[model samples]
Target: MKETAYLLQAALISAWWVGLASNGVFFAAFQFDAIPSTAFWAFFAPDVILIAALSTVRAYKQNSAIELVILGAFAYASLYCVNATVLTASGYLPTGLMLLGLAYNGFLCFSDSAFRVSSTSMTWNAIKTLIQTVCIWTMALVIVPYVILDAFDTFALPSMDIWLIIGGLLFACFSLLGLTSAFFMVRDGAGTPLPLDQTNHLVVSGPYHYVRNPMAISGIGQGLAVAIIFQSVPLLIYTALGVLIWQLVVRPIEERDMTRRFGESYVQYCRHVSCWIPTFGRRGT
Candidate 1:
């Protein structure tokens, strides 16, 4: 039975790669206006392949409940890709591409198997993290600026000044760095950033060697970058407030949690590493 399952899974994986490749070709053809309007069938092929592959892999690997949830997400992503392709055909190409990009991000954030979380516990934890992300973004980007600062009244896009362009480039670089840090946490520490799924190992390498809170710095840096690009005083204030909140509220709580979890090792780390600033020559525990 296991051999049969493995063979079936291998076939499904092969088919999925083929479908994905075909989708890429179709997209290229569409870009050059070489494909007809009825090319939606090409999108469906990949969608079906993704679904079949996920199902077969789940069965062959004996996926736990959390694993099943992850598989479900991939299935949803495949469906969303097909929907996006249809929307592209309908002339909303940018929106379609954005949706596809979001799906890809979701896949990156949730599909990994590094975190040692059980199925029952992970469901609620994942949902909580999702809600927290939405709330934080809404408050920082929308509520603080539009409602409190009334930034929309004086809204204008950023001019293509050299400084603004520099800010934009820095924003991209920092954003990528932050994502790499998170990926390292998962790969090295076997955990997600959420408290509910915190790492088993103490991660002292990579970005952690430079600073205590690279992710937080990245978050604040992104806000500053946006403010700089827009040249909005209100957005700048928003970024400042975000930093203050992190310092006054979040840092303390996280420190207490880490100390409790890691004890003497974490204390030594705190002593060596600066909280917000990068210390280049310092060795982290």
Candidate 2:
């Protein structure tokens, strides 16, 4: 369901906020939007609107689209303005949250009804997934670092591009892997990766031939690469958290879903190829 993304985003962002507040700067000094200020209330009101938009938003509905555009467009813009001029230190928090929220919205825009719907043309699947990929990559690779750089003034890395080069190379490789997996899912499986429109058939081709989850592997690797490139401990922790979530929470649900959907075929496939880890001598490719 599209609500899943919003709910997940809200939870992740809230955790991020709590971590920052409890660890280093509990509402850093020199803030322009401190409590009891009209400026604070102004930005706060927009945040509420942003939250409300996420709550009420639905996918593929013209009215929902219009509402999101009107409310989300202005609310995000207003928050940007405030972040630019007023908020200084912790200000970057809003920027990062907004960008991530925008990334989620990109997914919300393309997928149809919350639950799995009828199959769509491969073209539509490609388009929607492309938008989602671009938004997610931009937010994670670009926007997240920028926000961290700004907010974490004291958190400095070496003034060298060594890590950047390494991270960039690793990110590129995994991104290619992810894209290749998506392509196979679309071409062979006849669907997009969005839960709202999952693959119609079991996709055991291309990267899936070797690994059960090239995308998950790619995502984890890319996340680690980003953290390494930036020399960011926080990002490293984030990568670890991602791994735990995938292994503990997401993987179980997804595996159960796959079993329910595909039955014996999926179980047999799992028996052959390992999930992410390469079992080269397995019976099936």
Looking at candidate 1, the ten consecutive residues that score lowest on lDDT are 25-34
Best-fitting candidate, scored by lDDT: 2
Clashing pairs in 2: none
Q: Which ten residues in a row have the lowest lDDT in candidate 2?
A: 26-35
lDDT of each candidate versus the true structure: 0.58, 0.66
Q: How large is the C-alpha RMSD of every model relative to the true structure?
A: 16.6, 7.4
In terms of TM-score, which candidate is strongest? Answer: 2
**Count of backbone clashes for each model?**
0, 0
lDDT, candidate 1, 1-285, per-residue tens = 322332343354455446446766323322312345355445455534544445456546654553445445555655654565575453233233334434433432343332243233444445544565566656555544443223134556568898699779878877776666666666666665554467666778888887888878887887888787777775786588567555754466567667877899999998999988899988536
lDDT of 2 by residue, 1-285 (tens): 444444554456456545534664534421334433344436544444455444444323335655366346645654665566454444665554455456446545543333373275888878878887898778766676666655655356545688888888998999899899889988988887655568888999888888898888988899888788778776787678678656654565667677888899999999898896966555563
Clashing pairs in model 1, backbone N/Cα/C closer than 3 A: none
